[model samples]
Target: MKTKRFSLRTLLLTAVLTVVLTAGVLLGAAWLLLGRAGVSMAETMVLINTLFVGEHDIQTATDQALDSLITGLGDRWSYYMDADSYQQQIQRRSNSYVGIGVTVTYLEEGVLHIEAVTAGGPAETAGLQAGEEITAVDGTALTAENISEATSLIQGEEGTQVTLTVRGTDGTEREVTVTRSQIDESPAEGELLSDGTGLVTIRNFNSRCAEDAIAAVDSLVEQGAQRLVFDVRNNGGGYVSELTDLLDHLLPEGTIFRQRSNFGWETTVTSDAQCVELPMAVLVNGNTYSAAEFFAAQLQEMDWGVIVGEPTFGKGFSQQTFPLASGGAVNLSTARYFTGEGVSLIGTGLTLDQEVALTEEQAAALSAGTLDPSEDPQLQAAIELLRETEEPS
Candidate 1:
């Protein structure tokens, strides 16, 4: 009697397994048929996941599939970020975080190059200089595929230490250990020049950038500044909302820019009643991009300022970040923005009223904060133009 009962139980389990297998096959076939009938990509993904087999984490698989789909679009500006990376991006735009502060760029040759080091940050305190190459983090090799992972390893709770192997421009390597700490970024910096010009250098349009710029201008005015010079050299740009707010303060009431979405929807952004009525000159370079480029273009179009330096790095499209259910996010280029003159700065950047290219030596000196304004041809040209306006005709 016991043997008969055991055989019956085995038969029941076999029948259940067979039914599951058959159901999976049917679901897969249905998915194929729906694809042929022109089903949406989202629906197709759901069908594929419903019939997936073998050992796998469903969430991870879904994330990978979504990443693949976005990659297939062939849009360089659109990308998917994991949960951790998404959070880090948010922190960066907010201009604060806990990490060894350094901005890095991953080269096509798989080298991790330090682009900029924050003043007074842990990276700067550890004697890590810009233009150096980072070879490894905590002894693990750095590669294009692992750059984000390496960054994650470098960041940790405050008071944690991260060891990095760095290579100098001359190929000498050294290991440096840096401690993580909270960083509050001051994006806009101001100074009153000797010639009574207010020099407001906007590093990027991060959070509170507009407020900082206003305060900077106000302080410089109180110090007897007769003119303003807005420098955005090497500024890669940040939040668009912040950019618009900055423009609202600097430009008179008029059309600022027009945004056209993928679905043919359009929206026009106009300046508010508030404005800064001051003689201004904007300084830009090859690295001035996105919102920075727009800032220059708007001033040039309105005849509000004289634009100097090299042509900007053109990038007119604006990306919107969509948060995923898995805590990750995707930044997709949702719209292409055009200037008030109905010109798009996508491939061809903004044309400067006066062009001045900085030599390599001068650029290095400028980065080191040792470039004399009298020796800086671009700045000198701007100062001369502003001073000319001050003279009686």
Candidate 2:
């Protein structure tokens, strides 16, 4: 899964540094119509253009202006994306993208580590595996400061091949050429463990995600797994409607969530009386965000499941991406959301039934899909709790 784009985090933490491509023109318009503040800004631009010691690009300056304009809003959820990035975001929403299909994390040394290799993706087909290092993209060796730039270089027009210098887990290094294709990633996966435990990993909440997750749950039940565990770790969230549908499938008739805007208006999403009521648990980590976090919070709030793992840094607002004529776009936080209990999850996050923090080695193994249940404290605890708690009478 190519997690994180410019985040499902609608892919979130990758910040967009550039802004409205037409800001240069917008600046002139602002200068013409506005009063003293606009004049001051225009004066600064003029001074920089004439007297600056170094090369001063007016386009870059205008981009900075628009970027700063959004930053001034003081909302971390709001961000700007250039044209290409915005387009990638749209593709990701449809559960597809043009890339080699690997999820990466930056090491402390500024190196890129491949945490996941999408099954059957270009990277996987090219022999890339999890727990390896993408030392370089093409000939540009990855460095700490160049992580973002390196990632950008890895993405290109579909069908173009990108050379990746990969370091295997055995410590041997080799260069692998992977064709960048349109990787259509599945949003969910399911497995029935030997213990009759159904594991449904909902990687995202995007297009058709609920349908897939529901299918997985049903398949697991057909396999005779009475208890279930839903994995939403590292999930960045997606469409609220999808989240609502999934919640409705698992939870009984009730309010799934509530959306409130700054304008004092509110909207509520409710579920019917029908639901899947198996003894359940939601597995999470710090990267579990937005709709994913809300999914866990709702389950915990309604006593539908036990929330296991670390608490999420709470977020109350939901964002919507607005595209610009210049091909760029801005993802703005449009409304604050609440759990079904009508409470904000903006502080310590959802109540944890059991907080299981994995050791460094364990975390790495889990990321690489090598962590066995015996070695996974979170999974073991969740399964144990499900078995001992018994189904609700």
Candidate 3:
């Protein structure tokens, strides 16, 4: 009876081992099949290696490898973006992201500076001031580059909450919580001053920018504004079509700007609409780039407006995005644009008609909310030029 019990136990052990081996083989075969059936080789190998080596988590290892590889490419501008990041960038390009609608800039010292607050945006409503330094975003350190990335990340679906840490010019850090909202991002906002002058600020050339600009100009005209100041400071850029429409309303019947590709002088945009024949001034600065520069250069070439402020940002290269199968895209510079007078503004930016320099005290005073550029001496200079050019009809 004891011999029979030992034999039975041996038989049971053999059956258990056989089942385990069979299951292992089946799993290996399934993995191989998946590899053959269009699974990413890197992902498949990572899984298999993890199973065999029993070292690291497969997903973590894969992400780390990808991050390392992308960073090792030695291009600071090139980065590995996940699905959320990719979606956010696409939304920003399409002008549909929900944020506080504050344009930001990075100073040379890695400080995240607020450039402008869009009218009717959450930032404007929150009373965020320009020249304010962002100290942190949701506990993340706010370096210039990190702040830019964080801003994009903080901007989410409508009604989301974004906690920001701000350090004002007074050097005091405070926490500010802002709820994201969909604000009307009209590219232009204008009104007639008491002196019959149009005070217009061009935000960006988005989808409805030109229409908004025309409406602003028309409203100012109805309000008896005879002179115009087109503010394009801190304007990044947007739709080329919208820019064309804007120039058409401001420029005479002639070539506005020229685009040169490898094919050599591919296309020239012209003004089809009647010009708004008024004494105009285009405001530009170092932050003004791309479509803003295009508009400024067009007006400058046609002698339609006097450009005031600092030299424009020399970003004349045009980029186009191509989607990839992995749900990501590449923004590659494909062509270069030039002014209507055949001047390349890529490396050499457009010079201003008047160079306005602010003293350190003036800059500090502006940061402290003491000085407003709308009432600035520089802007007053532009308005005074309009006053001098005012002729009785």
TM-scores for every predicted model: 0.82, 0.83, 0.71
lDDT of 2 by residue, 179-219 (tens): 99988888998999888889898888999899999999989
Candidate 2 accuracy as TM-score:
0.83
Q: Which regions of candidate 1 are displaced past 4 Å? A: 1-60, 262-265, 272-274, 364-374
Stretches of model 3 off by over 4 angstroms after superposition:
1-82, 106-149, 165-174, 359-374
294-386 per-residue lDDT for model 3 (tens digits): 888878788888877777757777766556565655555567777777677766788778877556665454334355655566577778776
Best by TM-score: 2
Question: Model-by-model lDDT, in order?
Answer: 0.85, 0.86, 0.73
Q: What is the lDDT of candidate 1?
A: 0.85
RMSD of each: 8.2, 13.6, 11.5
lDDT of 1 by residue, 1-393 (tens): 344556877999999999999999987886787664334766666776798676878778777877886797888778998888899999889889999988887776556788778889999999998889898998987887777577788889999998999999899999999999999999898999887888998988989898998889888878888889998888888888888888887899999888899899988889987887778998999889889889988888998888899987689889999999899999998999998778898788988878998999888666655577778888878887877777564
Which pairs of residues collide in model 1?
none
Cα deviation in Å at residue 16, candidate 3?
Answer: 48
Angstrom error at residue 304, model 2: 1.3
Ranking by TM-score: 2, 1, 3
Give the least accurate 10-residue stretch of model 2, judged by summed lDDT: 10-19
